[model samples]
Target: MSQTESTALADVSALRADLDLVDAEIRALVGRRRELSREIQRIRQASGGTRTDLTREMRVISPYTEAYGRQGTAIAMALLEICRGTGAPPR
Candidate 1:
């Protein structure tokens, strides 16, 4: 094999390794978020408040959109669906 071809293969392998590491970190963060959601559910139960809060949802989503440069509205709506199913309000 040519030297350049071997170098390219090594570079690709390194990128794959980095991606795998990032994937694992993403999974961990997602799990943590789920736990926080559960805690929120418990708090709302204690307070006798609805599960969803549209205002709170917007607030929670804005920063993520700003930081990540994605569609905050869509993500918030999807989460709202989950919250609704859990007896949370749109707001």
Candidate 2:
């Protein structure tokens, strides 16, 4: 390959490595969020509250919505799904 092509390939490889790191961090943060959600569920249950809190959810989504517009809402919803699981009825 030409020198220019080789340099471009190297840059792409480096960017991909950075993306891998970001993905790893996101996964770790999501896992932590799930753990926190479990703890919150425990506390709410002890207080005779429902597992899902719509008000709190809106609060969670608000900042993301402001920062990222419509996509932010989608991101928050995905995070909530990861942390809280789908509201599926048991068989």
**Every candidate's lDDT:** 0.73, 0.90
lDDT of 2 by residue, 1-91 (tens): 9999999999999999999999999988888998899789888989999888999999999999999999999999989887785645223
Q: Tell me the deviation in Å of residue 73 in model 1.
A: 4.8
What TM-score does candidate 2 get on C-alpha atoms? 0.89
Error of 1 at 58 (Å): 0.7
Model 1 agreement with the true structure over 10-89: per-residue lDDT tens digits: 99999999999999997676557666876787799789987656688788778768876677666666555554455453
Query: Candidate 1 at 75: error in angstroms?
Result: 5.1
